[model samples]
Target chain A: MMLQFNVLAASILSQYTDFEEIDWNKMWEATKETLFMTVGSVIIVFILGLAIGLILYETSNQHSLAANITYRVVSILVNVFRSIPFIILIVLLIPVTKQLLDTMVGPKAALPALIVSSAPFYARLVETGFREIDKGVVEAVESMGANKWQVIFKVLIPESLPSIAAGITTTTISLVGFTAMAAVIGAGGLGNMAYLDGFQRNKPAVTLAATVIILIIVFLIQGIGDRIVRRVDKR
Target chain B: MIELANIKKIYETKRGKLTAVDGVDLSINDGDIFGIIGYSGAGKSTLVRMFNGLEKPTSGDVTINGSKISALKGKALRSKRQKIGMIFQHFNLLWSRTVLENVLLPLEIAGVPKKEQKSKAQELIRLVGLEGREEAYPSQLSGGQKQRVGIARALANEPTLLLCDEATSALDPQTTDEVLDLLVDINQKLKLTIIIITHEMHVIRKICNRVAVMESGKVVEEGHVIDIFKKPQQEITKRFIRQDTNPDSEDTDVALSQLLTEYPEGKLIHLTFHGEQTNQPVLSRIIRQYPVELNVIQGSIQQAKEDSIGSLYVQITGDNDVIEQAIQQIKNMDVEVEVINDVTV
Candidate 1:
C-alpha cells in the first residue's frame, strides 16, 4: 500500500515537477545539512550566550565582581555584534571563519559566523531573562553566605529558567532563518535547494515543498520549547 | 553578640553625596529581639544590612561574636554570612523551586550532604508549619505561607542571629500577628538573637523587648519597649506612639491643643500608667477621694511582652487645692502625670 501511494504521488509530482530532473539524493543531503548546522550552532550559541549574558548581568551592578571595567567592555562588545546585520557579519567574518574552521564555503565553515552573529542576539535575550528575576531573591541567596558561583547556579539561573527557555525558543527560530542565509556561501541546506533548483531553474513546486518542510521543523521546535517552559515554570 | 560602632554609609550619586546612615553606635546582646522603627529612607535598612555585611559601612566597625564583620572579605565574609540568616519583606523565595527545595538552598550552599539536606529541609518545613505543602511552588502559596517558607529557609543554617527586614510589612494584620508570634516562639525556643526593622510601632510593641527609633539617618531614641512607650524622649518617638495609639485623623498634639481651648474650665493632664497600674481603677479612686470632677478624653492600653502600658488624657475641674491633692494622689498610685494646662484661681 505504501509503495502504491508513493508511485501515485510520484506521478502527480511529475505533472508539476520533472521527477527525472529532480535530484532526490541531493535534496535529502541538503535536509541533513540544515539540521546539522542548526543543531550544532544552537549548542555552541547557548553556552556562549549564557556565559556572556551572566557576565553582563553580574558586573552590571556595584555589588557584583568587576562592576566598572568588565561590564563596560562586555556591554560594548555585545552591542557591536548585535548592531551588525547578520548577512554583512557573515561576509565580514570570512577571514576569522577561515582561520577557525580552515574552510569558508560549507556547512561546517558557516558555524563560526553563525555563532558570532546569533550568540550576541541570544545574550541580550538572556540578560533580559535574568533581569526579570527579583533583586530580593538574589540578596536572599547572598545572605545565606552563597558565593558568586552558587548564587548564579542555584538561584539566578533556576529562577530565570522559564524566561531563559523562552529566549532559547526565539533564538532557535532565528537560527533557522540565519541557517537559510548561510546557503548563499554554498552551504548545503533547504535554502540552497530552493534557491538553486527552484528559483534559479524556475521550479516553483520545489520551493514550495522546501518552505513547507522548514515550517514543520519550526513548529516542532516551538512546541517542544513551550512544553519545557511550562513544566519548569511554577510561578 | 552584635555591635555597631560609629557606622556610616554615604552614596555618591548623580544628585551628589547622600548619607544614608550617620555615625551610630548600637549593641545587641545574646537572645535579644531588638526592633528598629523608622520611616522609609530613615536608614534603618542600611543599619540592619551592616550586620550581615550585605551593606558595607563607609567608616565603622561591626563586630559579631568578637570578630569584626566589616573587615572580612571573600570566603571569610561568606562563611560569616552563613551564621547570620536574613528574611526579606517580599519573602523572596525562588518561584521555580518548590517549598522544600527553597528551604534546602542554604544547606546546599553550605555543602551539606544530599541525604541530610532533604531531612533537614523537611524538619524546617515542619517547624514553620508548612508540612503538607512541601512540593507546592511559591506562586501557589498565599503571602502568609510564602513568609513561612522564608522563615524556614532562614532558619535552615541554624544561625545565631536572624535579621528580619520588614518581614511582616506585606502581610495582613492577622498574618502579621501570626508571623510575630512565630518569631517570638523561635526566639524563646532556639534562644536566637533577632534584629527586626520596621515602620510599625505596634510591631515593636508586640514582640520586641527593646527598640531604637531612627529619624533622618540617626538613632533618635533607644530604650526598653515599655519605657519608650511610657516616656518618649524625641518628638518623632512621640508622633509614632500617638499614631499607633489613636485611630483618629488629628494628631495627639493637635487634639490636645483643641481640647485645651474648648474646655477652658478645667486642667488638662496627660497620665501614663504602666505594668500593674494599667489594670487598676486609679481614676475612680481619685474621684471618690477628692472633690475634683474627672472627664476622660482620649485613652488606650497596649500590651508589651508581659507588661501593659496605658495612656490617658483627662480634664480635671475643681478648686486649685483640691486639684493639686487629686494629682498628688494619682502620682502616689505609681502613675506618671504631666499637667497640660494650669488654670490659676
Candidate 2:
C-alpha cells in the first residue's frame, strides 16, 4: 500500500512539471479575468436590480397603488425572463448580443448576457428582501407625509438591509459559478484554460489542479459572503 | 380641534365587502386627550387612521383645524398629513437607522434643512426622555424604550394633532403606565390634541378627557369620560365599565342571591354618582331623613378626568311609600338609580 501511494504521488507531480504544463503567470491572468467579469456583472446587476425590484414592489396590490392589468402584464414579463435558463438564454440572445457588442464570444460581448441573466435573479432576491419587511413600517412612514419614492429609499431600503445583504451574498456566489460556465462560449477565464490545458491534452493532473483551484475560489468567496452576512444580519 | 363627520370605510375583501368603519361622527376638542375605545375590529383603529389620512373615507369629511382633509389629494393631502403625527401599537421605528435618524426622517421628508434637522431631532428626543439613546438602534432597546423612540420620531415635526393606535397595548402593565404618563406630559407641555384608540377602559380613565365607545362599526355612546363612566347609555359600554371597575362584580350576583334571604321584603338598588353632586353625603343623609335602613352590599369609586365618580349596590329596608319617596329624593340629587330585583331564591 505504501509503494502504491508513492507511485500515485509521483505520477501526479509529473503531470504538473511535464512539458507544455500550465504557465503559472498565464493561469493567474485567467483567474483575474474571471474576477473582473464576476465583480463587474454583480455591480450592474444590483443597481438595475434594486430599481426594478422597488418598482415591482410598489406597483403590486400591497402598495397604495391599486393593482391594474398593465402592472400585472409587466410582472408577467419579469417572471418569464426569470424562468429562462441562463446558458440557454445566452444561446437564444446570440444575434442581439453580437449586434450590440460587435462580437459574441469575449469579455465585452458577454457583459450584456451576464447582466440580462443575473439582474432578474438579483431583482427577485431584492423583491423578496423587501417583502419580508413589516407593512406597518411602510404605513408609519407614509403617515409622516413621505411620498412613495421617499418611503422606498428612506424606510424600505434601510429596514431591509440585512436581508438584502444576504441576497447579495448568495447572488455573488452563484455569479462566480456562472462565470465558469461562460467559458463554454469562448469567454476568457479559468474554465477556458482548464478546458484547453487539461481536457483537450488528456492531462489528468492538470484537470485535478484546475478543479482544486476552482474549489478554493468557491470556498474563499463563501467565507467572505458568510462573514458579511453575519456582520449585517442583526436577527 | 378635529371633527369626523359621518365617516364610513368599506373594505372589499375577496369574501365580500366588509364595513370597517360605519357612518360615525366624532368631535375632539383642542387640548383634549380623546380616547376611542372598543374591542378588536370594532372600527377604533380604522376610525383613528382616518384622522391622519392613512385611510381615506368612502363617504363624509374629516375636518382638522379648519381644512376638510377628505377633499385634499396628492401634495395637499401630504401637507395636511404633516399637521397630524401618529404612533402605532407595534412601535414601527426604522430598524436600520439610529434612534436619532428615525426621529429625523419626517423632518427630512418635510423638507427641513440639514442645518436644523439634527437640532430638532435632539429636542424631540429630549422631550420623549430618550436623549441618551439617540445613537442606539431599536433592537438595542427595550420595548418601552423603542416606543419612546417612536414617540420622539412622531413629535419631530411638531404636529398639533397626535394619533395613537393602541400605543401602549404592546407593553407590560408597568411600562404601559410609564408611556401613558409620558403621553400625559406631552399633552400638558405641548398642548397637543391626542386621539387614542384602545380596548382598555382603564387607559381611557387614566388620561382621556372624553371618550367614544364603539361597537359593530358604530359609536354606541360618547361624551365626557366622567359622564360615560357614571351613566353609560349603551349596554356594551356599561358592561366594559362594570368589568373594569368591578372584576368580581359578576360573582357579586351570586352573593346578592344569597343575601336576598335576609331582605325578602326589602328592595335592592344600584346607585351611580357623578361630578360635584357626589360630594354631598347622600348615603348618610338618606339614613338621617328616611324611614328606611340601607345596607351597602358593594361600593366603588373611579376617577375620570380628575373627577370623583362611583357606583353603589345597596339593599333598602322600607315600606313601599318610603321606598318610592326615598328613590325620588335620591334621583333629585342627579344620580342614576337602578333596581336589580331578579335575584333567585
Candidate 3:
C-alpha cells in the first residue's frame, strides 16, 4: 500500500514541474515588499485614524448647531471612504495616488490606497471604543478643571487605548491582505509573486509557500495585538 | 459663602423645553456641610453641577468666594473650577491610573510643580486611609476604596469647595458609613465646604448641618438639618424623613402587632425630640416621676450635625390615671407625644 501511495504521489507530482523548487531570492524580495507596505501603511493609518476618531467623537452628541454640522460632515466623509470595496478602492485611488506619488507601480505605490481604505474603517472602531468609556469619567475630569487638551490626553486617549490597540491589530492584518491585493495591479509583493511567478509559471509550490507566510504574519500580528490589548485593558 | 440667586436651568429637548432647575435661591456658609435632598430628576444634580459651572444657569447667578460662577466663561470658568472639586456616586475614577496617579491628575491639570504633585498625591492617598495601596489601580479596589481614591483625586488641588453628588449612594450601608465618616473627617480637618446631593435622608441626618428639600425642580423646604428632622414642613419632605424613620414599613407593622399582643392594656405613645432636647433624660425622668412600668417598645435617635433628633414609641402599663399623668409631663418637658394607638389614650 505504501508503494501504491508513492506511485500515486509521483503521478500527481509529474504533472507540475519545479513544484518544489521555489526561488528563495525572489521570495525574500516579495516578503520585503509586503512587509514594507504593511508597516508603512500601519504607521500612517494609526495617526490619521486617531485624529479622525477624535474629531468624530468630540463633535457628536452635542447641543451646538455647529458641532452637529461638523459631526455630520465628518461622519459622511468617513462613511464614504469606508464603504467602498477595497479592490475597487485601489483602482479608484489610481489617479490620486499618481498625482500624489508621481508613480503607481511598486509596493510604495500601494501605501496611499491601503491607508485611505483602512484608516476610516479603523476610525469607526476607535469611535466605538471612545463610546464605551463612561460619560461620567469625562465629567469627573472636567470637574477637576482639566482643559480640553488635558481631558483628551489624560482620560480620553488613555482610557480607550485597549480598543485602539485592538483596532490597530485588525487594521494591520487587513493591511497585509491589502498589500497582497495591490499586487494584482503590478505592485510587487508575495501576491504578485504568487500570481506572476507561481500560477502563470505553473509552480504551485510558490503559491502555497506565499499563503503560509501571509498566515504566519497574520498570526504574529494577532498574538502581539492581544498582548498589547490585555496589557492596557485594566477594566 | 456660596450664594445662588434665582438659578434656573432649562434644557431644550426635541419634544420641548424641559425645566431642570427652576428659580432656586440658596446661601451656604463656609465650614457648613450642606445637603440638597431630593428624589431622582428633582433638579438636585443640575443645581449642584452649577456650583462648579459644569452646567450654566439659564437666568441666574452662582456666586462662590466673591466670583460669579455662572457668569464666568471658558478659561475663567475652567480656572475657577480648579478651586472646586467634585466626587460622584460611581466613584468615576480613571481605571487606567493607579491611586497615586489618579490623585495626581487634578494637580497636573492645575500646573502644580511636578515635584510637589507626587508628594501632594501621596499625602492625599494617606489622608483617605489608602497609604499602602497608592500603587494599586481602581479596578483592584473595592467600591469604598475607589471612592476614597475619588475623594483623594477631588481634593488633589486643595479645593476649598467639594461637591459630593451622591458620593456614598453606590456603597453598602457599612461602606456608606465609612465614606461618610471620611467626608466628615475631611470637612473638619480641611474645613472644606462640602455640598452633598442625595435622596437618602440618612445621609443628611448623619452629616449635614443644613439641608434643602427639593420637589419638582424647586426647594420646598430649607433649614437646619435638626429642624427638618424634627418638623418636616411639606408632604414630600415628610416622606423623606419617614423613609429614615421607618425604613421598612412592614417591619413597623410587625413590631406594632408584637407590641400590642405583648401588652394589650399597655399605652403606646410616640415621642418626638428636637435638637438639644434629645440629650435630656426625659424618658428616665418620666419613669422616675411616675409609678408606672414604661417599657420602651421602639426608639431611634438620629444625630443631626451638632445635635440629635430622636423618636421613641413607648408602652406604659400601670394605673390609667398615672400613665396619663406621665404623658402630660413628657409634653410639658417640650417632648411632643402622640398616641400611636387609642388603646390606652
Candidate 4:
C-alpha cells in the first residue's frame, strides 16, 4: 500500500508541466463565469435576504410591526425555501429562469436560480443575527425620540452590522459551494469545467486540479472574512 | 411634574396572570429627588418603566408635563419620550457609537442640524465630566464612567425629568457614591425632576426629599423622607430602616432586653424627634426640672429630607409615677414615645 501511494503521488507531481495539455482559455472563461454568477447571485441575495430578514425580525410576535398573519406567512415561506435542496431548486427554477432572462444554460440564467436558492438561507441567518441584538438598544433609541426609521437605521443596523457581515460572509462561502451544484443544470463555472474536462473526457488530473483550486478559494475568502469580522466586532 | 393615576400592568404568564404593578397612583413634584425603595420583585422597576413609556400600563393615565404618556402613540409618543430621560442598571450605551455620538443620539433622532449636534454633545459630555473620553466606546470605560456616559446620553435632549431604574445598584460602594453625587449635581444644576428606584435606603437617604416604599406591586407607604425614617409606618419599611441603621441590630435587640434587667427602678422609653424638634433643648430642660436621671443608651441621628430625625432609647430612674408624668410631659410637647417593657409577660 505504501509503494502504491508513493507511485501515485509521483505521477500526480510529474503531471504539473502537463498544464499545456489543459484548455487554459476555457478554464479562464469558466473561472470568470463562476465569479460572475457567485458575485451577482450574492448581491441579489443580500438585498432580498436583508429585506426579508428585517421583515421577519420586525414583524415577529415579539417585535410585531404588522398583523400576526402576515408575519406568520412570511416566516413559513422563508422556512419552506430554506428547506429545499439547492440542486432541486436549480432544476425546479429552469422555466422561470428562462422566462426571466431569456436563457437557462449560462451564468445569467443561473443567476436567478442561485438567488432564489440562496436568499432564504441567507435570510434565516440574517434574522438570527438581528434577533441576537439586545432589546435594550431598541428601547434606548425609542426613548431618545427616534422614530421607527431612525431607530432601524441609526441604532439597530449599526448594532447588528458585525453579525450581519459575518452572516453575509458565511452565505457567500456557502454559495461558492452551491455554485458547483448549479452545474447540473448546464450553468458555466469551474464545476462545469471539472465535469466536462475530467468526467466526460475521463481525465482525473482536471478534477483534482479544480478541487484544489476550489479549496484554495474557500480558504482565501474565509480568511479575509474573519479579518473583516474581527475589525467590526469591537465588543 | 409627573403623575401616574391608577396605573396597572399585568403579565399573562404561562402559569397564570401576574400583576407586576397594581393600580399605583403617584405624583412626583418638580425638582423633587423622589426615591422608590423596594426589595427584588417588588414592581419598583415596572412603575419606573411607565415614566418613559417603555412599559405601557394595562389601564390608566400617565400624564407628564401635561402630555398623557400612556395614551400617546407613534411619533408623538417618541417626541414625548425625548423630554423624559431614563438610565438603566446595566448602563445601556450603544457599543457601536462613541461616547459623544451616544450622547448626541437623541439630538440626531430629533434631527438637530449636524452643525449644532456636535456642540450640544460636547456640552453634555463636559457636564458629566466626560470631556476627553468622547471617542471611547462603552467597552473601554469603567462601570462608573459608563454610567456617566449613560447620564450624558440621558441628558442629551435636555429633558425636564430623569428616571433612574437601579442606576446605582450595579456599582461598588465608592462608585455608587460618585454616581449619586453626580445625580445630585444634575438635579441641582438643571433643576431636573429625578425618580430613583433602588433597594438601598442609604441611596434614598443620600438625595431623596420624598420616598415611596413598594412591596408586592403596591406602594405600601409614601411620605416625606424624615417622616418615614423617624416613624416608618410599615413592617417592611422598619425592616429596611433597621437593616440600614444597624446591621447588627437583631443581636442588639436581645442584648437590650438583657440590659433592662440590671435597672429595675428605671423606665425604658423610645423617643422619636424630627424636623425642628431635632434641634430643641427639650430633653435637657426635662432632665433639669424633673427628679429623673436620664440615661441615653442607644440612639441614632439620620439626615432626612429637610431635617435631622433621631430615634433614641432612653432609661429614666426616679419615682415610677414621676417618670410616667415626665413621659406625658414629653408627649404633650408633640414628641413620639414608645415604652420598651423590661419584663417578658
Candidate 5:
C-alpha cells in the first residue's frame, strides 16, 4: 500500500509541475524575442520621445506665433497617440508597419506599433519632467551667458534626468506588455508561445512559466531603472 | 561707466499692458557699490536686469561700458551677459551640481579651457571662503553657503560688474552680515562695479557708496549714501531711513509720544552727523554751549561705505531762546538738526 501511494503522489506532482509540453528551447527563444521587442522599441522610443518632449517644452509658453503653432501641433499629436489602447494601436498601425517593415509576424515587425504607442506615452512624461524644473534655475543659466542649447543640455536635461529615467523605464515595461499583445496577431514571443502551446492546448504549466519569466523581466527593469535614478538624483 | 537713458520695461499680460519700469536715467561708475532700494512692486528688480541685458527695455538705451546692452541680440547679448553677473535672493543654484561644478558652469559657458576652469573655480571657491565643500551639493549647504557658491559662480567669468538682487534677503541676520562682508571684499578686491537691489535700508547704510530710492517705477531720490542719511528729501526716503535708524519704530514712536507728553517744556530734536562731525562729540559740544539739560532718547551710529553717519533723537529742556541758539550752533558745526516740535507748533 505504501509503495502504491508513493507512486500515485509522484504522478500527481509531475502532472501539474512538470512542464514537458513546454519546449525549453522554444521558451528561451520566445524570451529573447520579447527582450528584442522591448530593447529595440525602447531605444527608438527614448530618442523620439525626448525630441517631441523638448519641442513641446520650448514652445509651450513662448508668445511667438510659430512657437504657439508648434506647441499646439506637437501636444495634440502626443495626446492622441498616448490616449490609444496598445492592442488597438497595434491593429491601427498594421498597414503602416507592413509598409515600413514588410512583415507582421515576428519581434521586428511589432517594432513600429510598439514605438508609436509608447514614444508619445513617454513624451508626455518627459514634458512634465521638464516643466517641473525651476524657472529661476534656467534664468540663472542664461545669466551665466549659456546660450539656449547649453541651457537645455547642461542644465535642463541634467536636472530632469531622474524623472526622464523613470519615464523610459515605465514606457519600456508597457512595451513588454504590448509585445505580448502583438503576439496575438502573429508577432512571435512568449505570449504567442503560451497562447498556442498552453492556452489552446490546455497546458497550465507552460502558461505559468511564461507569466513568471515576464514578471522577472519587469522586476529587473524596474530595479535597474531605480538604481540609475538614485545615482543621478542628488536633489 | 554704465549709463541708462530713460529705460523702460512694459509687460503685456493676459489682463492688460503694465508698466514695470516707467522711465529711468542714471549713470553707474566703475568700482562704486551702488544700491537701489524700493518695496517689492517698485521695479527695483526690473531696473537691475537692464544691466545684463537680461531684460531689454521696451524703450530707451542701456549703455554699459560703451556697449548698447539693450540693442544686443543672440550671441552678442549672451557674451555681453558673461561680463555682468547677477546673484539672487534664492541663490538660484543648480542643485544637481556640486559647489565646484556649479562654479565651473559659467567658465564652461564662456568656453574656458577645462584645466583653467577647474583651477579658476577652485580659486573662486576659496575666495568665497567655501574652500573645502567643493563636492557638496546646494541642498547640503546653509543659506549663506549656497550664496557663497552663487558669488563664486558669478565671479567665475571674471565679470566686470556684479548685480545683487536681494542677495542677502533670504539669510538670517548673522549670515546676511557675512554675505555682505564677502560682497564688499569682492567689490574692493576685484575693483568690480557692484549694484545692490534691496528693500532694506540697513543694507544700503552698511555697504553702499551711493543709492537710488525708487517709488512707483521712478527714482524718487538718488544721492550719496551718507548724504541721503543726513538729508532724506522724499517721504519714502525718510521711511526707509527710519527703518534702519529706528528698527523697532512702533515702540520708538510710542515712547517718543510719551516723552513729548511728559516733557511738554522740552524740545524733541532730530540730529544727523556725517563724516568729521560723527567722529567728534557734536551733541556734547552743543549741550555744553547751551544752558540746557539733554536726554538722549534713541541713537545709532552706522558706517555707510567709507564714511560714518550718526542719527540721534534727543529731548532738550531749557528756555526756548537757548534751544534756538543751540540749534544754530549745531547747524554751524555741519550737523543737520531738525526741530521735532512740528506736532506742537
Candidate 6:
C-alpha cells in the first residue's frame, strides 16, 4: 500500500511543474520553522503577558496593592506597544531581536520580535479577562485571608482561565499570521515558502498548500482553545 | 467580639471626596447575629467591610477579640482575615472551580493540609446542605445554591466572625428566608459572630439579635431588634419598620390623607403595641370603658423573633372629653398612642 501511494504521488507531481519543482525537504524545514517560531513566541508571550496583566490588575485595584504610579506606567507602556503596527514593530524591534537571539534572519531570530509585538496585545486581553472577573470574588478571597500571591494564583488566574484561554487562542492565531510576515525578514517558514516560491515564482499551487497548512494549524488551535474554554468555564 | 470605634470611609472620586461611612462606633458581641440595616448608599456595606479590613477606615480603629484589626498589616492582617469570613451579595464563587474546590479555597489560602482541606470542605458542603453537589460548579447552581456554596466556602476556615454584605438582597423572598435560616442555624451551632448588612428590614427582623439603623453614612439608631421594631427613633428606622409590617401598603401619610377624607369628624389615633402588650385586648377594653364609637381603619400585627409588635389606626367618634379619656385609658395599657388628627364636628 505504501509503494502504491508513493507511485501515485510521483505521477501526480510529474503532471505539475510547480509540484515537481517543490523541494519536499525544504518544505518540511519551513513547516518546522513556522511551528518553532509560533510555539516559542506563544510560550514567551503567555508568561510575560500574564505577569504584566496581573500587575496591571493589582496596581489598578483600589483596595488590593493599589500602586497608582505603577498602574499608570504599565498602562502607558501597554498602550504605546499596542499602538504600533505589527510590521513596523518588527523593524523597530530589530536591534533588540538581534541582541536577544544573536541573529536576525531565521525562525529563531523572528521569535523575540514576534513576542515583543504580541505580548502587549495579549497582556491587554489578559487584563480584560482579569477585569471581567467580579471584584466581589477578589474581595471574598481577600476576606478569606488570601495574601496577594494567593489571590492572583488561586482566585484571579483560575477564575479567569476560560478568558485567558480564549486570549491564548487569539494570540496564537495572530502569531501564525505574524510568522508569515517574519518570512519577509528571511525567517524561513510557510510564509516564506508561499511568498518566495509560490507568489514570486508564480507557483499558485505551492501558495495554496501553504495556505491550507496554516488554516489547518489555526483550526486546530481554535478547536483546542474552545474545548479548554468550555471545560474551564463554569459560569 | 468585634468593635468598630469611630470608623469612617471617605472615597475620593473625580468629582470630590464622598464619605461612605461617617464616624460610627459599634460593638458586636460574640455569638450574636448583628445586622446593619440601611438603604442603598447608607454605608452599611462600608461598615461591614471595615470589620474584616476589606475597607480601610479613613479614621478610627477596628478591634476584634482584643487585636486591633485596623492596625494589623501584611501577614498579621491576612491572618486576622482568615478568622473573619465574608460573603457577598453576589456569591463570588470561582467559576472555574467546583463547589468543593470553591470551599477549599479558604483552606488553600490558609495553607491547610491537602487531606484536611478535603475533609473540611466536604463537611462544610454538607453543613450548607450541599452534600451531593461537591463536584457541581457555581454557575450550574441556583442563586440559593450558589449562596449555599458561598456560605460553605466562608465557613471552610472555621471563621469565628462572618460578615455578610447584603447577603440576601440579591435573592428572592423565599431564598432570602432560606439563607437567613441557614445563617441563624450556623450562628447557633458554631457560636459564630455574624454581622449582616442589608437594606431589607425583614432580613434583620428574621435573624438579627441586634440592629443598627444607618442613614447617610451614620448609625442613626442602635439597639435590640425587638426594641427597634417597637419604638423606632429615626424617620428612616420608622420607614424600615413600616416596610416590615406593611410591605405592599402605601406610605403612612398617604393612608392618613385617605382616612381623613373618609372620616371627617373623628379623632384619628395611631396605636402601637409591643411584646406582651400585643396580646392584650386594649382596643376592646377602651371601647367598653368609654361611650365612644371606634372605627378600625388599617392595622398590622407582626411577630419579630420572640417579640410581637402590632400597630393600628382607629378613628374614634365621641365628644372631645370622652375621646381624651379613652386615649388615656389605652395609653395606660402600655400601648403607644399617637393622636394623628383631631377634627371636631
* Candidate 1 displacement at residue B250 in angstroms: 3.4
Error of 1 at A53 (Å): 0.6
Place model 3 in a CAPRI quality band. Answer: high
Least well predicted 10-residue stretch by lDDT in candidate 4 chain A = A61-70
RMSD of each: 5.0, 3.1, 3.5, 3.4, 3.3, 5.1
Candidate 2 per-residue lDDT, tens place, A1-235, comes to: 9999999999878876564666777778778877888888889988988987776776677534455554576577778777888788777878998888779887655667788887877787888889889899999989999898898889788777876777777777777777777876788777767787677977755666666677788788778877877776643
Q: What lDDT score is found at residue B276 in candidate 3? A: 70
Model 1 agreement with the true structure over B1-345: per-residue lDDT tens digits: 888999999998889999999998999989999999999999999999999999999999999989999999999999889888899899999998899999999999999899999999999998889999999999999999999999999999899999999999999999999999999999999899999999999899999999999988999899989889888888789778877776552655676777678877678998988998988999999988988889888898877785888889888998889999899989889898888863221
i-RMS of candidate 4: 1.1
B137-170, model 6: which lDDT tens digit per residue? Answer: 7878999999999999888888899989889989
lDDT tens digits, residue span B75-167, model 5? 999998999999999998998899999999999999999889999999999999999999999999999999999999999999999999999
Candidate 5 C-alpha lDDT tens digits along A1-235 = 9999999988866755768777899899999999999999999999999999999999998989999999999989888988899889888888998899788778898999889899998888999999999988898899988988999898889999999999998988888888899886788888887788778887867888898999999999999999999999998
Per-residue accuracy of model 6 over A1-235 as CA lDDT, tens digit each: 9999999998766544456667778888888999999999999999999999988887886543448888988999989988888788888888987888789898988887788888999999999999988888888888998888888889789889988999999999999999999887899999999999888987767877788889999999999999999988878
Task: Compute DockQ for each candidate against the true complex.
Answer: 0.77, 0.64, 0.84, 0.63, 0.70, 0.75
Candidate 4 residue B221 Cα shift, in angstroms, is: 1.6
Worst 10 residues of 4 chain B by lDDT: B336-345
Clashing pairs in 6: none
Q: Per-residue lDDT tens digits of candidate 2, residues B1-345?
A: 788999999998889999998999998899999999999989898898888788899998999888888888898888778778899899988887889999999999999999999999999988888888888888899999999988888888888999999999999989998999999999999999998999998889889999999998999899988878877888789777877777686777787887676678888888888777667799888888899999998988887668877778888888889988998889998889987777532
- Can you write out model 3's per-residue Cα lDDT over A1-235, one digit (the tens) per residue? 9999999998767644455568989999999999999999999999999999999999999879999999999899899998898889999999998999989899888988999999999989999999999999999999888889999999989999999999999999988998999986678999998888888987777888888888999999999999999999988
Question: Number of backbone collisions per candidate, in order?
Answer: 0, 0, 0, 0, 0, 0
Off by over 4 Å in 5: A1-16, B260-266, B279-293, B317-322, B341-345
Note the residue pairs that clash in candidate 4: none
Computed on alpha carbons, the lDDT of every model, listed in order, comes to 0.89, 0.84, 0.90, 0.84, 0.90, 0.87
Candidate 5's TM-score reads: 0.94
The model with the greatest DockQ is 3
| Chain A TM-scores of all predicted models | 0.89, 0.85, 0.93, 0.91, 0.92, 0.88
Give one digit per residue, the lDDT tens place, for model 3 in B221-246.
99998878777769798678767876
Q: Write the per-residue lDDT of candidate 4 for residues A1-235, one digit (tens) a residue.
A: 9999999988877664356556778777877887888889999999999898888888876644455777798888888888888888888888898788888888787887778878988888888877888887787777777887897788767888888788888888888888877888888788888888867886666766777777777888788888888887767
